[model samples]
Target: MLGVPKDEKPTWISRLAAQPAVHRAIRTFRLQELTSAALKVRPIKRRLPKSGIEYRVRYLESFLMADEIFQRKIYREAFEGLDVRSFVDLGSNVGYFPLFAVELTGRRDLVGIAVDGNRSMTDETRWHVDHNHLANVKPLWGIVGYPSDVKEATFYLNPSNVSCSAQPVLNPDVPSKGRIKEVTVPTVDVASAWMQHAGDVRVDVLKIDVEGFEREVLRTCGALLDKTSSVVVEWHKWIASQDEVEALLRDRGFVRFRTISEDPYCGVAVYRPRAS
Candidate 1:
């Protein structure tokens, strides 16, 4: 994979872009407002600065996500000092985090698997992988759950948003007209699915953002949890409190390093194996 451009703008530019004041100003000033409004009818390709990778996205959700992953450096701390050769992404929306990982690691042979329950989101993720010639990253479409939970599951799709969930009531916007679409998707175990792609190789990093199904998704990892070096998770407060999230990981022999971000809806934290 090609590296960040030498002539790319300074890191401060990205820091500035990540600031809340600047983000609000950009929206308030109608900088992206007009463009975003126009793009609602059709999606467009936007490149991440420095990485030379372009992602195909339609709504403001993706724009905000791009800024969070690339500009805000949301997962940077989780990735630092780790030898990331293989990664697994659960509930990958447009697959920005996997792409960011590849760039941050600067590893040409890194392998990534991005899994999403939404077929459209999977297609979008595939486009990014193919367009950027990221052959090592594989996008799989399926609902990740415990191995014995169900063979097929109902996935509540949020057409206007990427944060779909198995729990119908999880999306607050679902009460509105035509906002939610119910679809049955095949379910796969996380460890089993990953083993099919990378065999028995240890996962360097595992990222989870599965709406309100974080605990169920984590259950599917099974023994692979022992083989993973670090985990970055965005836990929904309604499904599990921050302490509950920590307790779940603790039972699996992982300890929380620190939280990256926290809001009413969800919080992101990094975890590593407990020291002997």
Candidate 2:
């Protein structure tokens, strides 16, 4: 309840539990089971036969993300026939997206830059890249969506590792078991950093999921959008609406062609240059 917004309405389940002592007891029992499950979670080693890659995921969220990327095929179109020689993930958690790119493209030579604001998560990403022998994938510990002049920024690390975000006020509601932690991380400007990492090659696929700081990310994207071929962004409407995000991309000559998934809290959309 700490992170719940003041104006937010109670969820149906919350309302249901408030009706009777029996309902409240049921809710309490369910919550206890959920907490027990969370406590028992341990590192899991999973191998994707198609990709021929073994993932070392520590958290339940990481496994769920694996399901999203590998099973759901949310970004399938982004890699279908794009000849993705290079890609960048703005909020790479444990490097699943880039791994999926490698799997989807079947290109071991593919170059990827995975960036994360949380040091622990970034380290996990690096472990995945190293252990899996993804020679071309580089894991960076930094924050994106800020001006190049800005060297470092404050980042909030949520208990759900994948929910780590740059915007302080955009923190997601967490279980009462854990509190949000703040840390300063180095900032990256995609334009300059991309060139430095993978040379001047146009970005084959650009995946952005910086929690709710997407507007800032797009603002600093500058001319880099022109050099990008495909963009798959997960937009948080609570901080910046889908329309606002799409408008920013439209201004840079992009058109939203697909809405992979959507909900009240967030949505994932794919974009491509209008001329293409």
Using all chains and alpha carbons, the TM-scores for the candidates as numbered come to 0.82, 0.83
Ten contiguous residues minimizing lDDT sum, candidate 2: 1-10
> What C-alpha root-mean-square deviation, in Å, does candidate 1 show against the real structure?
6.4
Tens digits of per-residue lDDT for model 2, 129-237: 8988889888889998887889999999866566678976642332222457898889977788788888878898999988888999998896678899999888887
**Cα error of candidate 1 at position 148, Å:** 4.1
Q: Which residue pairs clash in candidate 1?
A: none
CA error at residue 182 for candidate 2, angstroms: 1.6
Q: How many clashes (backbone atoms < 3 Å, residues ≥3 apart in a chain or on different chains) does model 1 have? A: 0
**Cα RMSD to the true fold for all candidates:** 6.4, 6.7
Q: lDDT of candidate 2?
A: 0.74
lDDT of each: 0.73, 0.74
Please give, for residues 1-276, the per-residue lDDT of candidate 1 as tens digits. Answer: 011122333345444533457645654665554565777578777776666777766655676677667765678778877878999888888778777886788764678789898997888788878888888889999888757557899999864345587766563322322357899998877787778888999898888888888887776675778888899888877677778778878989999886776644567888999872
